[model samples]
Target chain A: MESLQRIDLVGFGSLLAQLQAEGYTLIGPRLEAGTIDYGAIEGPDDLPIGWRDEQSPGRYRTLPRNDRAHFGFNATPASFKTRLHRSEETVLEVQRGEQGELRFVPVIPAVKKQAWIGARSCELAALAIQDRVLKDSADPDPRYAARREGVFIVAVHCGQAGGTCFCTSMNAGPKAEGGFDLALTEILDGPEHHFVVETGSDAGAALLERIPHSQPTAADLRRAADAIEHARATMGRHLDTDGLKTALYAQAQHPGWEEVADRCLACGNCTAACPTCFCSSYEDQVELDGANARRTRHWDSCFNADFTHLAGGPVRASTPARYRQWLTHKLASWHDQFGTSGCVGCGRCITWCPVGIDITAEASRIRQANGEPPK
Target chain B: MPPTGTERPRLAVWKFASCDGCQLTLLDCEDELLALTDRVEIAYFPEASSRMLDGPYDLSLVEGSITTAEEAERIQDVRRQSKQLITIGACASAGGIQALRNFADIESFKRTVYAQPDTIESLATSTPIASQVPVDFELRGCPINKSQLLYVLNQALFGQRPTLPTHSLCGECKRAGVTCVMVAGGTPCLGPVTQAGCGALCPRHNRGCYGCFGPSETANTQALSPHLERLGMDPPALVRIYRTFNAAAPQFQAESQAHERD
Candidate 1:
């Protein structure tokens, strides 16, 4: 069992400085262009304090809150994966010497030690899914592996659920279950605002000893638990994952697919916003002089007609086929590829999708069409 | 144009009837152009250089649409001289926004736009280069993306087959992780039927896709039309969306014709 400590709201800024002192760049959710995006932060002020986000299928708006709580929102569209696996990266560069000798240089990405603060429970679950896909496999990606090393995670428990969120149904969130260096539950009910911090690892415990904190009483611990419970209860959406894989596979040609296809623009927004979806394409660029060239890899989406392009033509040639491929792969075939489902129920797909297509609703409709009980 | 001392592949740029936006994309590759010049010789490009060289060129990048009788014959000669010909931008691939005249009376358009219609000497229809001669490849976009143009040039130089995505604009939107303007804001978007390129620009700015890159490989505009209808778009509005840039594309043209108000 790890130890728990109570840290006041002001002390959180010091913790960020201490992480910087230890040579880790702090990344957290900050307001940008009317939305909260994950970016670099220097102190507690950089966090989205006293700001709450209202999210729905196809809509997201931020509102001001009465209290000055640093993690007031549920989740940001930006995920932790952006830091580990960049959107675009140069993999190789080739140059020719004076003697006409060709020199090829592998562009190894410089690894940076990072500390991710204000991570939600679902976001942590998404990171774990990426770890299984990028690492702990037969062929681990060296770029992702290098960037993932020596990273610290500071998870914050959700006190309220967004309209699009369904983490509880996915059994992935509302509280930090594991996979975090430290977990914090903000207690804002009393006259003074404080956080009930719990260390999850030896490194976290050692860091906790360096910070100024007090022993949390029994009431403080209860309040932290109650906050998490309240969040889980208030979730606006639910998805029944019991036999979801088998159910989706059985309904490959279900009528529900065509209905969703009508609304689904095949825009690939859901997959791009999804934290676990890892598809990419390669580009070979030659310099103007034509003596040298560089190869780069960037994020790609399965929704693309060219994603499954062949010498003859595209494999999935219809909007329904493309939409079906994305949904089935995410909820069904992903289990076969990786030992887990691709979704962490973060609701980014719902919030970011231009047409406001809800994955949970679509899945439930498919389930009912396949003779399964209503969710 | 024959290869010079370095024996580098000779590249030529041709323009017919366009906004000159696509040709400017090549010049916009400032960093890559300096390096590309080292590998490939710019034999003839009126937009970038005054130096004109006689062909048979190794590779030809043709922009714009065939809107005149002279250009219709000239493109055939360009095809015969170039070893590999790749059409760039919507004008070269799908006849471009000027193809909107195909739906209206061309004679009236000429009389309205030009002071003397008899001296205009324009074809009734603006057609893509591929309609007249065989094109090796077609890069789709209102103005072709610089990175994609560089990739195609590199592939041609190395004698490797160039791979360009024929996917919908949805893929770019997803990869960018931009919130969907259509779904959330009820904005009518052509991203589902449009080809992937332009990096989902309109959606990033909280607007809908205008189908500037032409139709995707397997565009189901029929299905997407109903969704637009549900978003309160009528038949005339639907026709307007499909009849923008790349209006002469068969998929978009057929869909627009289907939704014609009259």
Candidate 2:
């Protein structure tokens, strides 16, 4: 029995218009190049209102739902990190001065205010993880921090889980939890003809004030509760997160890794698609005059044969070695450094991987071989 | 050559046969680059610095594998000049992707890959730096971790033992709370035997590991081999895993040899 406000359909449109008037670039989900991706939104019409995503290993397809369920999906292939941490950033530039004193300039990325529409619970949790690694630290990443602070989030509750989603097992989930400013559950069966909006932040409350809406009735709340309940019940994917780290670590000597390494080509497609993977390498470039030195940062993957070249040679010379570093760090050592699990259980790595390697199945094999319960 | 009364440690970066990814790690330290420069004199690094000073350097970071006779000779000379020489990537520490040539006929591989085989001058097999000259330390990875690189350099500069993880990448993954890609997702990964580095990136992304950090200390490859077979991996495929970048490493080499029986 909590007090809630409901904005009429017209009021919601005007609020979005008001946001545009305020010079905020409103971006939401749009069918672009055959994918339901987050992009520029003119209004609600631009969103994939009747479309839902079907995600699985080596597959991502959008299908029309029976009813217009806006937030019917668990997670999308696209994560917010792609825009925040760009693929390439020029770190250095070298130029000769008039006096011939070599000058090197390090370039920092320009920050922007991004308003994200239809973000999910798991993605919100993921953003928190990014904050801890990139911005929450004592030496925060200025560029990432600026973008993070300026961005606004409009989270949508998942009414259905994708085939590859295991957010529930990861303790991240169907329900829109904390971290999002505004949480909305789109219920198509309701006669109220609107979204159930819950304010989770001051920004959300302020935005609510601008939208024309009235207080929600008891029936609307009941319907919202039912939609969430239905989503929780019909989850398509499940994972055992109980003692997962220990089960895998205990079998550290297990030969299953070599088996996996056999099929893996060390292409690094998984790391590229992952929402949380954030390892990077830097580069230096000199201007044509060779007087100034510039440094740049780019995404680096451990699977590459040169990721760890030293004066004498590389330490991990085998693909098995590189693969081990990736898995072990993610499951075991990340806790030591970051104090939380690095994986949010998004299965993008499985779908986008050219070889279609399933992470959960491999972990289970190792666990079973070691006479351990599936965790 | 003696230092010009400078107390700061002189650092040198060298490459043999590589893709230049490993040497790039040093330059990749964007936030720490300026600070690190203040601590050490970058005496030599042809790829990054235009000023290539004569060696007799304090510390030298070498990347790539010894794939030629000339490189073999150069490493020995480098060993003579540097006080501490650390091999950074898989190529230097083991043999690297080029080491794949080890399994095949060296002459045939050269002929197949290069249009003009005579233009390519290579050793019979790609080999690690340790096989050529004495190495003070070896940093494990396909490309060494920047954090680890920074740590090793700091330790060398301060004359302290660099505290690097000798455990498998599986150990790091467990600590990170990353779901086991192999266990949770049934994605084949190589965390058990592979060295700890790369911060368990593949699994964080929900994919199995393709070992790039080489083998860990006390890697029980024999035990893991049978399990891989149980998981439906054939011996040839398993051998390919062992024969990757770190194929020449004793641990991986022996494992690959065991699979050759099939």
Best by DockQ: 1
Candidate 2: lDDT of A220?
78
Q: After superposition, how far is residue A274 of candidate 2 from its true place, in Å?
A: 1.4
Give the range where candidate 2 chain A is weakest over 10 consecutive residues by summed lDDT.
Answer: A284-293
Could you give candidate 1's per-residue lDDT for residues A105-223 as a string of tens digits? 98877778789998899988998998898877888888898888868988899988999999998789999899999889999884858999989888888888788889888888889
Residue-wise C-alpha lDDT for candidate 2, range B44-162, written one tens digit per residue:
99999799999799999999898898998999999999999999999998888888777779999878889999998888888999988889899988888988888788767667667
TM-score of 1: 0.91
For each candidate in turn, the interface RMSD (Å) is 4.0, 12.9
Please give the DockQ score of every candidate, comma-separated: 0.42, 0.03
lDDT of 2 by residue, A58-100 (tens): 5566778776655555465557776666555765676777877
Task: Single out the weakest 10-residue window by summed lDDT for candidate 1 chain B.
Answer: B1-10
Superposed on all Cα atoms, model 1 deviates from the true structure by an RMSD in Å of: 3.1
DockQ score for candidate 1:
0.42
- Deviating ranges (above 4 Å) for candidate 2: A1-3, A103-106, A109-111, A190-193, A291-293, B1-262
Candidate 1 lDDT by residue in tens digits, B66-87? 9999999999999999999999
